[model samples]
Target: MAKAKWRSVDGIVLLNKPIGLSSNQALQRVRRLFQAAKAGHTGALDPLATGMLPLCLGEATKFSQYLLDADKRYLTCIQLGKRTTTGDREGDILTEESVPSLSDESLESILDGFRGEIEQIPPMYSALKHEGKPLYEYARQGIVIERKRRRVTISNLTLVSRTADTLTLDIQCSKGTYIRTIGEDIGEALGCGAHLHSLHRISTAGYSPENMMTMEEFEAISEQGYEALDAHLLPMDTAVEYFTKVDLPETDTMNMMFGRTIPSPVSLDNGTVVRMFDQGTQRFLGLGQIKGTMLRPFRLVNTSEFSL
Candidate 1:
């Protein structure tokens, strides 16, 4: 059969990623479904994780960096009393200990220490590069490579509930945090080793899973054609909606799009980034940042193609 022709569709889709597919694998599936000429994902979730995977198609891909840098939240279950090679249920068990019966106050105190800023040693089973090779490759070869401890902030960490051998947590953290590492550290503090039993991203980039389109749902709507699928996508500007919005006159909009810096209509702190838009129509132009007193375009959309 002949391959379908790809089209230039633009927008964001909030997908409730099912467990077992890597982020890139999930992205490819969505891209083919939309038949978009270009597509990207904000960040990768472990194959074991499920939920809130944001897929950006066409011009929406341009704003994915903001989503990548945005704070994220997850609901996870940390299995106590076991240390695994990969730090999750996927890897082989290296050690096991009897989980201690503890009071809520004691468990809460141990979790508190993990809150705020903490340092973590990236796992060998991760995609982090070591001498241009992914760490996981070395892990597969049984070669223990020296790793460095990197700093990350845990904005919020709440103990949701606990089972006989599992502790469930609701974690909101900054970019670059590895929940697997957090699980190990928390276990060590509690005098029992631990590994992540399950992970689920609850939200990121100010978006939640409540509006997500699941794969099961998409399969049901698949044969209805692309226009039906398009109805589910969010406008490209929604990715950068957290930034301040600045409406510009037509002349200013043209100048900004053409890579010219224009005088600011309203004063904002130097280096403050804003979303640019056409004044009268409120059409999104792109993104601009304040330099000294001028608004310099940083990332401008192709107004000729989509935005007027």
Candidate 2:
């Protein structure tokens, strides 16, 4: 018996994650289907949450930073009259409050207060590192730690619908905005606490759930053949599409590969993110940032291959 032949394919796959699966679990399933040598996801979705998780296969992993910083949109459900330890249904119920009878007009008015720039403290049961240890580790041991408030922007937040006990919301926020916290905050403002019951990420930056495929769907295609799976992959440059493109001559390409700062054809000001490409083939070399007139290597892909 011979081992299956694996082709080296590099690109991004917008994954539609289902509830109850961690982000790593979803990435592993995609990796097995593609048989990729290297793969990574731009952001981690909580096991309770679902939708647009971008999986980067092979060289696409190098551009994960760009996707990580992209704004995200989510549709979430909040259950009033409850507070959870983790701020979501997964955590133990910390307390219960009497639900206040409220109208749609009142709910909408309260939600309006959460829009725009605000400060939030990250949940304890999070992956954020604290002195070389994950905060979740301490949270599991029944230890409460003070978390610093970080500024986050909620570009848009609207109360979609409301029932007597539950409310559905649509939110567009900057990176690091936690929907669970928003639910809790809304609860606080209404004079009745709340906790997240259901959360689904509909989009991340430009990647939408409509473009995503579930793990089961991916597996079904993989069982058929690799070509079926390959058809779903987005190009490696998908995440960097917003950056300014700079075509470099072969000499500059060689210099960039060696991590050398070089002059570029474009007159970009300092600190501008730019995508680098080969002059002749227009192959994506890597990413560079402008500092004055010099192009400095911010992130390079396979430097050894392009080295002179």
Write model 2 residue lDDT over 1-308, tens digit each, in one string: 12265557788999989899899998887887788888999889999998889999988998887898999999999999898898899988988889899877877788888899999999888888899998989999998889999999999887788888899999999999888999999889987789999988898878757788888888888877878788999878779989998899989888888899998578977799899998877888878999888899988777455533
Please provide TM-scores, in order, for all candidate models, with all chains considered together. Answer: 0.95, 0.91
Which is the leading candidate under TM-score? 1
lDDT of 1 by residue, 1-308 (tens): 22378988889999999999999999999888888899999988989999999999998899999899889999999999999989999999999999999998988999999999999899988888989998989999999999888999999999899988899999999888999999999999988899999999999877857889898787666678887888999888988998898999888977887889999987999999999889988878889999988999889887775344
lDDT of 1 at 18: 96
TM-score of 1: 0.95
Which window of ten consecutive residues has the lowest lDDT sum in model 1? 299-308
Instruction: TM-score for candidate 2, please give it.
Output: 0.91
Q: Name the lDDT value of residue 135 in candidate 1.
A: 91
